[model samples]
Target: MNDVSMPYETHGRTGQKSRTRTALVTAAREMVANGQTPTVDRAASAASVSRATAYRYFPNHASLLAAAHPETGTQSLLGDDPPDDPAARLDIVIRAFTTLIVETETQQRTMLRLSLEAQDAAPDHAPLPLRQGRAIGWITEALEPLRGQLTDEGLHRLVLAIRSATGIEALVWLTDMAGLSRDEAVDLMRGSARALLASALPV
Candidate 1:
């Protein structure tokens, strides 16, 4: 059997496509980091790529920004050898999630602002990245051990409640409206997540 039958040309072509996609996304991310809500054309200009090429890659500002979103793919907040206790597991998840928010605070705020504008411009607009279920999936995974104890409805409700207390929305309110420092906000989220777990599971 020929293990290399896939051919170098195919590999090279795939690699090129990956690089092009990365370039477009990187341009959008850098523009977002600078506090500019960029159109697909602007990202193309920043990437030194043609607008047509960029459009082929991202299609619209929403899709472009979605790919560029800082929290777009944060799948696992858990560590190697994660604790089996749901409360402890959730604490670890909250701590890691809050750390991400602090590090990408600027980018998160930009995405949030754009999400608001999109919501206003069209009530049925495409979902912004942060509003997608990435965090929910991760949190659910962390709390998987509780499945036996919780009905599906109960588990879902608990996830939503914890999500409401954590994540970027909570950070914005805690820091901007409540005037807590970044560290203070993180601590508060961790505490809230642990408390929620305890109440829900009652071990």
Candidate 2:
């Protein structure tokens, strides 16, 4: 008896389809980076594949957008450890987030655009502040030790301050608006984050 479980035709077609999908996704990402709004047909053409192939991989615009936006579904920069020393942990978290923002500048900008569009299209859509609050919550946890020193209101203010001081908006302003290089922007952000943390959560 022959093993009929493995459908050779389907298996071969699936492998080909997977490669084509990867190509289309890559093409879409490049197109987005180049300031083009990639459609299924456009992405397929860019990838040198068929529109049907692109549709097979990305059923809709949302799927393509999700793929093109790499920052989506990423874990917190702070990682697993919620440090016992709140102040130290805050510094670490801020540093990590700043580093990410600086490194993935284009992706950060794209995220900001997507967020604004989402909010405009649907007022109930999750706000960027709420999305950022996850990181801020980690920062707040890190500042737990200093909770006694600072009031709840003060802590909240400090969290907003730190986030504003080190976020991609600042980075964009410095880099694009102010014409600073990526290295210069990152260094500025690092300095600002450190200064804010030091002043707000003094050891």
Candidate 3:
């Protein structure tokens, strides 16, 4: 299972090869943080490694970019033993989601740029990694306890509202435009999530 988590090319000589793979991934992440959509060749150059070695780890642009996205591995925000109360579940998920965005803001920003660029090039296509609506799934799961309380459409709308407020787009506005610190931005997002959830519940 651990080997499945490792890059396939590093399986034989794990030590040195793993370090090299890490270097390439770290270099790719650094480029992404700096607002560059890096290629395998570019990452190799940045890492001071040979292009051939980098290609072994990431064969194509999409694979390299995917590796650079920090949230690619996260399928859920709800921890084990999640509460049944919708509000509590939402609060827990929102905190975790907001922390992830704030910590990986740079990588998030890079993917946002790429997603927008892809949109411009091809409208109506499924969005790139950052815009793939993974947060929607997480939010929906958090609000699952509300299913009997609200209509399907109402619950979906509430989930969308919470997701809109808590995602990277809102974070960019809160921190970059509104000049709030990251922690302040995260707090506002959490408040927004709670407010949206409350507004959808019984009066």
Candidate 4:
């Protein structure tokens, strides 16, 4: 019978490629966290993979960046069944957003840098706005009962405020720039969100 193990060489190559792709992503994230630009060669070396292997998965800078930053899609901390009460739902979303920011610090920073770089290279490539929309959609749905209380402009302002308060920009400022510990920063964000909601929403 023909030997199935004969293709060991091909299997080894596939395994190496998978390892290289993982390494490249890890290295790229680290570079962004350290405030350094992540180039293909640097990422390859950091991942312990050859430059050629890195190119095989990510043909160009844009492709590599896009691969590194993926949206969480429909998986949100606030489950599909939103709370029946508007205020309770808002609380859930605010807490979820705050937790997400604190927990995904490294990934958040990498995404922020990737977004800015992509915007500079090609304004149309920016994905931050789309991501922001997803967050706002959650907030709006939760606050549907208070729809009449908030004007369109007011709602927009609220979304912008929340986004600004919970993203990488805030994380970096609180942690690196302002010298707050991760826990402290997260607590501060949670408080800020609560304060905003209390002030913005009607009684």
Candidate 5:
């Protein structure tokens, strides 16, 4: 809610305060990774920084948790050696994406929950990460070879289908309710992505 679209700037902070803030964010991330929603006080205690200073850094739980979300800043899921084939490229992307989701499952789930709750609370104006379109860009890049093959609208639809079939929400349901092992969930996620791609661009 706090104008997250604005560039994340850690300006106007002295050395000590900046250190304190870093410590607090690190503590919050650790708690989030361990399946706990952290509070300013808890993070402060964890960091050995005073609660007052922690409050100064993150005034609300949402702000702290949002900050805890991993900032990949990556444009493509492909590794240094990427394939030229569209399906193979997308498969690489899905594999890397699912691996990261499994590694940071707890934090990803927390971010998804916050985004959902925020949207449910107010249908209009969903903020950071969710509305940011980072995954969309990555998926689009992965399917870049299909750009000329399919119409723009068709390609967009395919991208959305892949996005819907993967991510934290699917990860949560796959592991939590569906009772799939981590490897099983990743396998299904990759399979769904490839199936969707094949449907769009048949062999």
Candidate 6:
């Protein structure tokens, strides 16, 4: 019995559909990595899939771009054996997060451009996945040890500050504007995360 409510990929010929979806997403990511914002049709062409099939997976440009975003579905930045100390945990998470940002800078930049364009096109448009604050969840999880010591608001503020210092936006300014090397930018971001956490701790 086919469940009509299921997603297209899960409905029929699941293996082949899943492969088609992965190919589309892979093509889109490759395009994004090369500094191109890809449409579903373009991604389909790149992936050697038909336009009709691509549209079945991604209904629009926004949906395709969102699916291509490097950080779209990430749920956590910490490792399986993350330390209990909030500072150590934060350091681990921030380092991993910044590394991902640097390695995927091209994709990040494309998404950032799209996000800005979307904002300019519609003042009230919902933010793209790039600006949707997934890092906040990761940072908050890394700093969860401080939840008891600090109020929820305080912890949230700390998370926001760290996120502000350690993401792609900060990376772009540090590298392009401040003329820092990628390594320097990452180090500074990690230091800023630690400093923010230290400030929130008792002296």
Top of the candidates by lDDT: 6
The regions of model 3 sitting more than 4 angstroms off are 1-24, 44-60
| Candidate 1 segments exceeding 4 Å error | 1-12
Q: What TM-score goes with each of the models?
A: 0.89, 0.60, 0.78, 0.62, 0.77, 0.92
Cα lDDT tens digits, model 2, 56-163, are 667766567666664444455556866677656766777777777767677668756765676787787544432445556656666777778888899888878877
lDDT of each: 0.80, 0.68, 0.82, 0.67, 0.77, 0.84
What is the lDDT, from 0 to 100, of the residue 178 in candidate 2? 95
lDDT of 5 by residue, 1-203 (tens): 12242122345545666566678778888987777777778999999988776777777666776666764435567888888899899988888888888877878876677677768887775375444666778789899889878999999999999999888878888988999988898899999999999899845
lDDT of 5 at 62: 66
Best candidate according to TM-score: 6
Per-residue lDDT, model 3, residue 118, is 69
Q: Which rank order by lDDT, best down to worst?
A: 6, 3, 1, 5, 2, 4
lDDT tens digits, residues 1-203, model 3?
A: 11123356646887778778778778888898888888889899989999877877777666677667777668878988998999999999999999888888888888888878767887886555445577889999999988888999999999888888988899999988999998898889999989888888998
Deviation in Å, model 1, residue 128 alpha carbon: 3.8
CA deviation > 4 Å runs, candidate 4? 1-64, 122-132
Model 5 pairs whose backbones collide: none
Worst 10 residues of 1 by lDDT: 1-10
**Which parts of model 2 are misplaced by more than 4 Å?**
1-69, 79-83, 117-134
Residue 35 local lDDT, model 4: 63
Give per-residue CA lDDT, model 6, range 1-203, as digits (tens).
11121277767698888778778888999998998878888999999999988888887887777777888767788878889999988988898899999888888998889888887888886766446677898999998988789999999989998888988899999999999999999999999999999998865
- Model 2 scores a TM of 0.60
Of 2 and 4, the candidate ahead on lDDT is 2
- Can you give the lDDT of residue 9 in candidate 6? 75
